[model samples]
Target: MKRYFIILAVLLTGCTKQLTQTNPNQQTAQTFWKTATDAVDGVNSVYGSLMLDGSYMRFTHVVLNTRGDDATSNSPWDQIYNCGKFALNVDGFAASAPFTAYYQGVFRANQVIESVPPIVMDTALKNRVLGQAYFLRGLYYFHLADIYQNVPMPLTIAQSSSDYYARQVSQDTVWMQVISDFTKAATLLPVSYADVTGLDANQFGRATKGAALAYLGKTLLFTKQYAAAAAQFQAVINLGVYSLVPNYHDNFTEQDENNPESIFEVQFSRSVGGTTQGWGPGDPQSNWAKYEARAITFGPRNFAYCDVQPTKALYYEFLQEPTAANQVDPRLYATMFYNTPTMKVYGQSFQATFGVADSEVFCRKYENDGFVASEFVWQFASGINSRLMRYADVLLMYAECLNEEGNTAQAYPYIQQVRARVGLADLATVKPNLTQAQMRDQIAHERFLEFGLEGKRFDDIRRWGWLQDPTKLAWLQARDPEFKTYTTGREYMPIPLAEIEANPGVIQNKGW
Candidate 1:
């Protein structure tokens, strides 16, 4: 699996040697967009950005999950703690990394979209490549808009240094751009690599029609276009391409990379040898680009830096309902490392190494069994694929959309499918004939349980309008005291001060 991404990394960076040798003073687009290989590499660079420190592979947790009620920045990293506590100002470290990383991706994608069409290559291949760029560009913007509601929307390649200073656009305009990109991508992308005539099986991780539709639905869902979002999600379901993996834990493991449930994922490789470059003080020579470093950041203090830890609220949430066998939700065991003597983490006893104290629960989702004492780099180089979208999420989102559309009765089976997978009773049986409001609450609970530590909770709170609701805000404050200072206009992250100074045209988010 790592070999596939390794080859992708090589194809992305190595194939553009001739283009890189052009005059340094000229614009990159003027010299670099000369061949089919350049176009391919351009889109590949966008994919490469996903593996960067500030993107989905790492700091996204700090920006999204840690800010929610489920987890906290347990390490003494002030920036991440500040983000989790809603104390982020313009100058904070958390604001800059993702803000820079996402725009880097947007810039790369913009070059691909603008430069690829005129190369006179195989038309189908060019369209496929452009489709990927569009998908990625939309994804980058989605992250930006989702985090910082007011963001600059730069659609074209930057021709000069001044072109970089884009003014902030409204959230509606950014979301429209996101929708447009994904819609264009869906039309150009094939349903799968198998559907493409000459593509190899190893190229399975590229953007596809299903991925575009799934993301499009997600964008719509986030913007409160429930009916339209449901249509897109149903289209994905109708395509018959994805399903839930039998074991939920398999979704997070390296062995199950690109599993049936994975609608879209950031591909990482431990085999792409280079220095680990991320937020941690790991082996500088470790292959960070090819690895998912969350394990190092989220694991126990002994094996890792332990930046983020699961909260007691999340722990008890799992115990709220037992399975038919009267066992704890298996997902709890898969998602966290508690003081259970039977649990083995990274091939060691969790209690012996990290202690059995009730207060010490670390994330276990990305921890692999391949780690050994001699290979300390494994801590930073876990090749586990990070899922960006899951079929389970699709089901829940669809269920939510249905309930929102005043079809609460029809939403039961979708919720039941997720619950039954974990040996829990059907939601319909437990809370039969629920009203629309009741079903909405149940879906929220299910999503929290299903997607905790996967970076979905914070988005869930935001979309549910919980952040603005006094009752919900109080509920969050009870679970995570960080919400005590969470104010109304501060829902979106502040524009980085560096960005504001550099791009004078760019306005800061409200209350920054």
Candidate 2:
């Protein structure tokens, strides 16, 4: 051993520089958050998670939209089909993918929140960075609370082995933390990035004050604090930073993303960032391209595998109300591609390429049919952004808050504003003086048509308690056969079995 040690020291005698070298490409917790760029990069990493497979990249929207009566999945994969049918394969990729993706977001956000503050940087820039961190953590938890309904709550980054396994908290406790984060974010964030002075200056997708307030409102609404929710939403409206884009379809495309209507959306690019299609929680700065797989999953047929499609009920829902011109609603044309006269898919006649079968509907909302001739062109590398919130939704939610507060009449103008955009007859003229219950039904009808296949219907129905109400559940089952399989307490996706097995403190959701 002594002889070998002497020889080894002699062999490295002239390699002292190599022995002392540190890998500049590698960044660890201890070395990160040392500069303004480092802080910006940290927050950017939190945003990066939204593009991963488990997050909005694929599974999140797929399961969220498909579980509702408005959409159905016909994939060959049983796990995909199961999620839409309200029978989530708790241990499978469909369930676990999003579970891990969201926590990955939470973990990155934790790092930003814990590490960025101590760095010396421009005061305003530092605040913006921290504000985004809080907003993102809140946003991730908002989805976590709604989708899983109950999960662990960790506000700070783990510093020790014991810190890694956060004990599960009740749904309400998670909501409270979410509320706190959003509240802090609202205070620290600017209304828009237009005036921002740092790395995110004038950026379109990073969280803004309005975005934070909107989520705060949504979280409040989700938790049934109607009055509090109303205030936050009103604050967003008061910010005066957002408005509905005249062309509704503009809200769904890569070309028109982050428009005035889009309050918050995940940024994606085909040629930038990680471009790989693998679904693991790999490094954010790795080669997994900043692209979303959802377009392929929901893309129109003939060009891509149309795993998901709009339910017939959704197709007919738009038909139930003709435009003021006594013609088919234009919004319907923008939302989906079904066989119709003179209708076109990717500039090809809808009836010519696919025979007139009204029952078969494929989503057109997020596809590149308008930009590229074929979805096959992009395939898995879809650069289309995933819109998480929009001002149009805010208007609808605010109206809901008002009606729930017994101010039914005041809710009229808000819903009416959304209707007038599409040339629908004003509600005051078509259905005047609606009672509270009548207005409630009217908003449900409006939201049904306005936000189809936007990953919002399930949350809408759940919050309205439609799934638990036997009469309402029967109504849903009548429109979607998948709803027939829905049973009590299964409204929320099951907590992943892997989570339960890995953490002794965690328990499965009730129905599973």
Candidate 3:
């Protein structure tokens, strides 16, 4: 299970030695890669990277959730507030933390991919491990490519110290590597590990055939290869291994992790009870901070940090579409805690708890407030698994791809599936026969509501290139005032000074 893997990661120690000396009893890189178990552990190290502070545990969600028109952050902490407004420097956690964390994932994946092949194991299991490795490497590179744009592409593990110093490459080159890795992984992965045995049993957190294919499709779609992207998404659909779960809120909480709808999610857990900003050499018997802190950071108002919330524009979008029940989109209640009358938050009426007017909006998507009496559960050890990709996302992306290809009619069915789950009116019946451009706008509206704070809005924004489009950028400026400060080249996070200082091969991104 992943619990075992996380424990194994925390328990493992770093090597320390006198100059030119080695400990004979200690396992070296030369001696470690000798068995199937080593291969499993090696790949698991990649998964462990997701739980650290820089990745899913905190900063990645911060970067992904905040820096868009959909969500707003108002942390008194400038580092937190500035990140949302695209006012980052070459320093600070916002600029560097995810950069460090994801590359750490890439490094771990590289080790597994390099070491696993010659270990003389069951062929199927070996392929599975390598497949996971490739997928994870691609996933990490995908994040790096999105955030940094132009970054180094290191396909293999370093042999010598010099090998670690990789030269920077263009974003297109990075995208090529991501597509290549995902393609290789898709070929080697299976549809499910539910029926699998041995080391990988009960490990639904691991990457699989569907995940690789979906991500590959996403990469192609992001790159504007519409036809190729459509084919990949359709291939994933043809697999029939995934579907939308009925409860939309279930996707965010710890209650239903690795469910049928989740294509890939970062695993996190709270094995120990105590939680007081737990971070040190992770203690297995004590609080080790093995939980994700995304909720606590995103937990609106008095529930947690009140650091992030829905923009007025986003809240407004939720009110535009009423479900068949004649209520405003039900997903909105699941998404945020606003000034709606009789709306209870964490078992108390909204007005009774906040004592505020109709001006403020707070997030509810990933909080533990639904189950816990207080925000204590979300403080630092919020064990909610961050769902990185889902079947719903795949459906919408497929629809977008179809619309982009001028198949506006073909896109309707996919959009209907997502809408039907939410009890919204069918587009074909209500707004019949949308043109390609109309269909594109409709899909954007759906995505904005369905995935407001789930970390997809920013990607959708960039992919649409609202920044370059005078009209769209003006609309964004209207919706989110932070866009007023956004400038050319600031869309990509600046290269951290630490990275450039450590490795001369890399250079800073423009417009820092």
Candidate 4:
């Protein structure tokens, strides 16, 4: 069922059709919502939007990770560089892509939520379908709130042109709505597709109770509701359905995709084929649309375009805490590639000097690594699935929440589990008897190593108030230099100009 979802997702792209109806003479969308298949299709459309360029699966990395101190965009593309430099303008693709992509998902999800309930289908299936819609709606809104800060909350499907013009809501209000949607989804979703006896077990990629709970916990964590968030993370742990993959590298490879460690991931497949009709210049294959561009963009310029490179500081971070063997953390090797003769990347020997300037170091977490071959184009066409949530992340979040709740002693084991997986010593052995502040820093350090290039750094610094603290801000600036340009009011991205133009009353984010 997971494979089916991947195939289905690859074939569908963002819905270009607008939901708002300015003219009554236009064909009623009601015509398309009358069947059970429509419900399935409606939800599938939501999933399809995940593959869009602006979605979390791809470009959002610019905002999420590139903008952080750990990485910088090496590409000449203005928008990509601006993203890493925190100099994004309202009209750039960086601002508009996420705005459009996430809302496109919200629109489709609303269609399913509003139109699917009325269809007379098998009760379990109907609720399950609706569950996914609600989950997706929550997920999209969560991204919106995280990125845009202040965004309109449009819960219902738009029935008229005016309905599209939603007024911006407070970030807190948007978060509450996110929690509401995920809470409803948790109740309706099954523990797993395997639990739904009649359904295809491959329905593995679909939203499940665990996914909803994990995300609900994540949302709560973002809001600093430590006690409540810890409870939700604990509930996911109690499910006994997920665990850290034995091999840290497996989590990033195609062979181990959707493994137990993956709670939810954006599905992609080369075999499913791209949504576009023809492969353009520098395209990997005719099926370029079916794959994610992360591998290509983050890969070494010799192997790919190498748009985003790990900062030297991130490399030094791995060296900060070595394994019991006093060797570099194993995850360092798995996460990045430098010009070491002993290192082999993408089935090719590593060379100290690559064709592109400042391309000696590259991200390895999502690089193709020649696992599947399609020539140079493989950079853009790698079918590796992008993991959105991993069990390891859950453990770290749980540890952070536990520590915040004054259970500093209890947090050790959760974080230890992550370190143990990578052959690193436990926190108790290396840094025992720590104060809450010390443990909190340990958790932050651990997360930096564990989820680099996975898009968690910017959020981590922001939530920890590091970005707001002059001392910590100086630390970041020492590493990336770009941090010097960061200002308090500029943390959230600007509202896209197009959105403001469309809704004349819409206000832009503070810094913009």
Predictions: Cα RMSD each: 5.8, 7.1, 4.3, 5.9
lDDT (Cα, tens digit) per residue for candidate 3, span 16-134: 45356678998877899998899998887787777767678888888888888888888988878988798987777677777777777887788888888889998888999999999
In terms of lDDT, which candidate is strongest? 2
Please, what is the whole-model Cα lDDT of each candidate in the order they appear? 0.80, 0.84, 0.82, 0.80
lDDT: worst 10-residue window of model 1 = 1-10
Candidate with better TM-score, 1 vs 3: 3
Summarize candidate 4's per-residue lDDT along 1-512 as a digit string, tens digits. Answer: 00111112212333457575556665346677877777776787788777767775468776788877778886888878778777888877788877777877887788788888889787888898989999999999999999899898777755555564678889999999999999999999988897674343447579989999999999999999999999999999999999988889998988889899999998887778655522221112444466777777777766777778888888889888779888779898888987666677766666634422334568898766756442275545667888999989999999999999999999999999999998898779878988999998888889989998888898888878988788999999999888878877788898888677757557899978
Q: TM-scores across all candidates? A: 0.90, 0.94, 0.93, 0.90
Candidate 2 per-residue lDDT over residues 383-477, each given as its tens digit: 88888998989999999999999998899899988998898998888899888889889999999899999999999999999987889989999
In candidate 4, where is summed lDDT lowest over 10 consecutive residues? 1-10
Between the candidate structures 1 and 2, which one is better when assessed by lDDT? 2
lDDT, candidate 1, 73-170, per-residue tens: 76687877788887876776678777777877887788788788889888888889999999999999999999988888888754454564567789
TM-score of 4: 0.90
* Total colliding residue pairs, candidate 2: 8
